[model samples]
Target: MRSHGIVLHSLRYGDHRIIVDIFTEAAGVVPFIVPQSRIGRNGIKASAWQPLALVEVAWQPNVKTALQRPKELSLWQPWRTLTIEPRKTAMSLFLSEFLYHALRREQENRPLFEFVTKALSWFDERDDQFVNFHIVFLLHLTRFLGFLPNVEDWEEGCYFDLQAATFSRVRPYHIYYLEPEESALVPKFLRMDLRSMRAVGLNHALRHRALEIVTEFYRLHIPEFPESRSLEVLAEVFE
Candidate 1:
């Protein structure tokens, strides 16, 4: 089965083999093993299977498939900015980690796929002023994951109740709540898209804080969401 997919992550296995987790149009999320040759084998190159790379994958399905094999693979879109720009690369790494953990289902989600595809393209074309891209990406991603923050309850003096996944005039009695100021940023993110991402104004501290809040918001919603190891690196770049 030929499917277009995004490479979520890849791990090298032993010597010449690599295992990749891909979110595909046909199969949702699936793992594949790639065997590299000595040289000039004309197979998929190791560099080709990069994180968040868009590619057309030829899936080799199995009867009791724990991991599928790719008969062929080709790059779909080459991201010039994301490849060469260090900040964008770091941002992409963080976002890729979030996607790896957040999108757990092995089922097709065309809408989510479409949204991600467009967002990546936007990231590739846009100039360097978009520091808040990841924040907006993380917040908007909640909509597809089925836990979009309840913007309805957003009002003055209301805190975001992470536990209830909504807003409230009174704060929750736990640590999983956002302060009023932090809560206010949620709607700003909700209203943002890739094109208007530059309109969000925040200092280094506030942006970092908002990213933390978004991370916590995801962790609250997704029990298995892993701690983002790339977070510290991303924060450093922003600072």
Candidate 2:
């Protein structure tokens, strides 16, 4: 089937080949090959597979096989605001990498699609703190991953255990637990929009602690994710 989509992220294969993952509204997620995508600006231009650039898409399953091929690709727009800002650019990189790992092959998730697109639109539109964007995105993403804990568990003195993906009024043995001050951000997080997320004035310690909780959350849910490179980079950006 033919469709339109955007390159979520890509990885280099060998010396020049590239394996591309794209999110298509019409066909969900698919991987494409940009043979020798690295060497020639004539083909992919510059950083074409970076993130969040809309593109033309073409797809069809191989006969007698589940794998599909995505061809007929090109960028739909320049992503002027997303590409130009360093802060937003970093967010894009972080989110795209996470999504590439989280979203599986041949799975269709319309709501997740819309959530990401809208969040990107929010970032593209205005300048804001950019400090707390990842933390807010982590909470919002809980809805898509099916791991959002009971937010009403925000009882005082309780600990948040990222491994169990739950909240208990008692302190957990895991050092990854969130202290009361950090846990207090939950209600505020529940009120955040992607745009308003930037304005969230979480203290540095709480913000870093939030990121740690979210990353542990990802580890529990995503079996394949060994580590997130964006973790350190995002911390520096927030700092």
Candidate 3:
């Protein structure tokens, strides 16, 4: 079968092979075993497996095993800035890792796939004023993940209950809720798209807090969603 995919994670498998987890348009998250021989001047380059790299792949399915081998693999859309730019690269690493965990159990959803690909392409094409990109990306991603908070329900002095994915006038009975002040930002964030996000000026502290809340929101919704290690790297890079 042939499909386009975004590389989520890659690791050395053994002496001469590598295991790459790719989120494909046709199959959600799938692991592919790639031999060292494929990483050469005349074949698929090692860079093609890097985090967030977009590639076209052809592979035969094996009901017996979860890991499949790609027969034909090549770059689907070469990124001009995402891989080369420092801040964008950091965002890519953090997002790719986040998606690896977030989409592990995802099934084929063409709309979700299209959303991701288009967002990444938009991110890659931008050159500046994108420091808030990751935050906006995470907020928008919640929509496809089935736990998007109800921004329409937001009101003055309202709190956001992370566990319930709603805005309310009363504090949530549980600990997983955002204060009214922080909760106010949710509707604003939800209203932002990639282009308008740049207009919303956020300093380092506010940006970091927004990310923390969004990450925590994910943790509350997705069972066992561990903290992202690359978040620190991304913060430092943006700082």
Candidate 4:
């Protein structure tokens, strides 16, 4: 199946090889390798596959339903400014690593793909506070995974229970829950589509709160995923 996708990441397979992972707008996650990807300056080289680079991928299995490769390739973009911005670069790196492990392979997710593309474009355009971008991404991403929690799950001024992925007027059944203020803020973010760089109305403190919510949400749902290491640095930037 041929589709448009964004390169998520690439790492050396052996000594002189590259294993790249890409997420197609329609075809979830696909991974394949390129020979001699680590070749030096004078070799038939494969370009460095950076996170969020767009490409049209032609997926074909080598023999049966075994390992596949992209029969065709092209650069969607280079992300010039984003690659240079220290903060955005760190966030992108953290996000790519998180998705690399969490997103399953060969599933179809048009909405999630659309969200990520929107996010990358936002990173390219604006320079607003970004602590909220990941939080928004995680919230919106739940919809793609069929786990979108209803805001109505809690009435106004209630609590957001992360473990249950629900809401309540009483105390949370679990400790990792969103208080009233955080709950109120979620709907505002859930409605926004712009990137953090383009234009967003978030202060660092609110963004950090959102970040905490996001991490707890990840723990609630994605059991095996580890804690986000970039968050502390990201928090400092927000502060």
Candidate 5:
């Protein structure tokens, strides 16, 4: 079968072979085994399996096997600076790890796939003003995951209830809620896009805090969402 996918992450298998987790448009999230000989052949280097690298893959599907080997692979798009730029690379790494965890067991979700592909291209086109990208991405990603926070009651005195995924005039007694200041910002994120990112007034502190809130929101919705290791790397880069 022929499919297009975004490379989520790869693990070194034995010495020269590698196993790649891909979120494919046709087959959802599937693992692909790339043997030693195929890695560097036809400009498809092993390094090309980097996080969020778009690729067109031809592979045979077998009912008995979990991992499918690609017969043909090619870069779907050559990202100009995502891999080379420092902060962008950091953001992509964090996002890649986030997506791997978020979409690991997903079935074929076309809308979700389209959203991710469009967002990656958006990142590629933007330069340094993408500090809020991941936070925004995570916020929107919730819609697909089925826990998108409700900003319907967003007003001057409203607090966002993460656990209930709703907004309320009365503050929740639990800890899984955002403060007024933080809650006020949730409405902005509800309509955020890459084109409007530069207009956002977030500094390093606000960005970090927003990230914390969003990550916590994810934790509330997703069972056992572990602490992201790439987070520290992102913080350092932003600092």
Candidate 6:
């Protein structure tokens, strides 16, 4: 079968092969074994396996095993700056890690795949003023993952119930909730798309806080979502 996918994670399989977990439009998350021989001049380049690299992949399905062998693989959307620009590279790394965990059990959902591809392409093409891109991306991602916060229910001085995934005028007894001040930012963020995100300026401290809250929100919703190590790297890069 042939499909377009985003490279999520890859690791050395033995000495000669690497196993890549890709979130494909057709197969959700599928691991493909890429042999060493496929790395030379006449075959698929190693760079095509990089995190978040969009690629067209052809693989044979085997009912006996979870792993699939790629018959053909090539970059479907080569990024111009995402791989080279320092900040963009950092963001991509963090996102790739986050998605690996977030979509671990995801089944094939073409709309979700399209949303991710379009968002990443926008991020790659953006020249500057994309500091809030990741936060916005995470916020929007919940829409497809089925835990999207109800921004429409938001009102003045409403507290956001992270566990409930909704806004409440009264604070819940549970601790997993955002205070009104922090909660106000969600509706604002929900309103901002990739292009408009630049207009809502946030200082480094506020941005950091927002990111932390968002991460915690994910932890609450996603089962066994571990803290992302690349998050610190991304923070340092932005700082």
Model 6, TM vs. native: 0.97
lDDT for position 44 in model 4:
24
What is residue 42's positional error in candidate 1, in angstroms?
1.6
Q: What order do you get sorting by TM-score, best first?
A: 3, 6, 1, 5, 2, 4
Question: Clash number for every model?
Answer: 0, 0, 0, 3, 0, 0
Q: For candidate 5, what is the lDDT?
A: 0.86
Candidate 6 residue 128 Cα shift, in angstroms, is 0.8
Q: For model 4, what is the C-alpha lDDT against the true structure?
A: 0.69
Model 2 lDDT on a 0 to 1 scale: 0.71
What's the best-to-worst order under lDDT?
6, 3, 5, 1, 2, 4
lDDT of 5 by residue, 42-64 (tens): 64676568889998888889889
lDDT of each structure? 0.85, 0.71, 0.90, 0.69, 0.86, 0.92
- In the range 65-123, model 2's lDDT, one tens digit per residue, is 44455555666656767788777777778777777777755367778777877776666
lDDT of 2 at 119: 70
Residue pairs whose backbone atoms clash in candidate 2: none
The count of backbone overlaps in candidate 1 is 0
Which segments of candidate 1 are over 4 A away from where they belong? 38-41
**RMSD of candidate 5 to true structure, Å:** 1.6
> Stretches of candidate 2 above 4 Å error?
37-47, 63-67, 173-176
What C-alpha root-mean-square deviation, in Å, does candidate 1 show against the real structure? 1.5
Per residue, candidate 1 scores C-alpha lDDT tens digits across 139-199 of 8988998889878679978898987888998868998888897788888789878878788
| Lowest-sum lDDT 10-residue window in model 2 | 37-46
Shift in Å, residue 219, candidate 1: 1.0
Poorest 10 consecutive residues by lDDT, candidate 6: 39-48
TM-score-wise, the better of 2 and 5 is: 5
Candidate 6 or 5, higher TM-score: 6
lDDT of 3 by residue, 1-239 (tens): 99999898999988999999889999888899999988999988887899999999999988899999999888999999988888888889999989999998888878988989999999888888888888888888899999988788999999899989999999988899989999999999889999999889889989988988988989989988999898888889888
